[model samples]
Target: MDIEMKKYLTLLLSGMSLIGCASSDDLSLKQNILPLQTEVCCESASHFPWFRLQQNQDLDFELNASSPVNQFDGSKSYFSAFTFAQQSGLVEIRLRSLMLDGEVAIPQVELLDSEFNVVKTIDDAFTVKFSDAFAKNRYELTEKVDTVKTPYMIVYVKTSELGKKVVVPHPAKIRAQESGEPMPIVTDPTYLASNNGHFSLSVETITLSGYNQKSLVEAKPEEVAVVQKPAQPAIQAIPETQSYYHNAIRQAVESNNIDKALSLLDEAKALNIEGAQEVFVRAVNAK
Candidate 1:
């Protein structure tokens, strides 16, 4: 080869070697971030607790000072980790933290594959505030993960979300709305965000057959059995009272005292003397 061509090939090989070194350095840095202790907590994917999440079952957990701290991103925070059981399908995860004394945890999730590699990072969880009569107000996060591809998950609060507050309508307003009463104007309550708190996690598996069945059931109108009420016994008229009112109204009408006949009709109607109003109407029509 020419001298110039030889020089160009040498430069290209040097650049390729530098690129390989940089890639190796990045991998090593990632491996070094794994937590040293495996028994106590999950700083690494393989060290995560084996959690057999049943379909539509909720698992309650608490993160306090004793919880394991993760500093994988250069910020110290507590986290909960789990590895799904075999046969887990398309999984829907719901995380909830009740607002206790105006404090709660803001949760973010990371989905990892079986090989301890992160497949997806769900940092932007759409959180919402929920209140119900049976429980205290709480914050909820719902996200779906295909467990067949990503079977591991980690729940944690990012450092940026720490000290943030979630504003929600006051409990008084919610109570008023639920009770169908006039709502009172009150300042909205705020929940202080923290990295450690009490939370519950629920998992639901979705299958095509199950979803189709549910849709069909919902689309079908509910059957309401026609309940025929038994007929009430007829009220027998008191012959004496009925005769007295009828005779009085007819006599007044015959005497050309139409006003008196109408007055008598009103009294009979107040007394519930049946057929009195009909007699008055017939007399008026005839005249």
Candidate 2:
């Protein structure tokens, strides 16, 4: 090669070496940023502990502690869209955290419209605790009229404290408007704990003809009342004396008082109660 060409080649080699080193440095930096623990899991539909949007037309979100991270290492955080729905340009969204071992500082919640476009963003700082035994949060957002378009959406949950950041994911998809489907009667006792003590929350359009309205929260008192239906009715099948005893047994089971249930069964057995077998089964199941 000519001397000039040889010099050009030498310079090119040096530049390529520097570029490779920079790329390696970048990879290392990312590794360092991830959490040290392994097995970080974020929320997903299959493993999600809790999530519900009253209205299929409304936006709702919940964060999970499980996040799929790099190497399935607990250090990496993941994100998934919990709920995304918009019809007639109005949308309501709710987001909450399930709590973690230590306090978690959540920094942002994002909303992606149809077509994977980022339509809304909210900034908030909150700490969550699973040990609280209850969700101590309720955040909401209202968006203007817009058709549901995004098939793939994501929620960005992150906390920046001690110069470290952790994110969890919950991917979301669009579904048919919930208006046609009958709203489930909130008769399940478990629904209250899962839905922030609200037996039901709905997402519906305000205007029937125009897209000039907002999404509103809809709930029915009947739903709550049904869930709170008295236990007296459940034991009505038995005689008066037996009904009283059965009521006590049901209460013990409901309270998760296994010992009490067993004790009540023994008490009935001593009296040669006719339903001793059924009562014993109920007591065993209570435990």
| Candidate with maximal TM-score | 1
Kindly report which residue stretches of model 2 are placed more than 4 angstroms away from their true locations once superposed.
1-65, 68-76, 86-88, 98-102, 105-107, 125-153, 161-287
User: Which residue pairs collide in model 1, if any?
Assistant: none
Candidate 1's C-alpha runs over 4 A off are 1-43, 175-183, 208-287
* lDDT for position 153 in model 2: 30
Model 2 lDDT per residue over 107-148, tens place: 354454433345655564333322223343232233333334
Judge candidate 2 against the unseen true structure and give its global Cα lDDT, from 0 to 1. Answer: 0.34
| C-alpha RMSD for every candidate | 38.0, 26.7
Cα error, candidate 2, residue 163 (Å): 7.0
| Top of the candidates by lDDT | 1
TM-score for each prediction? 0.52, 0.30
Per-model lDDT: 0.57, 0.34
TM-score of 1: 0.52
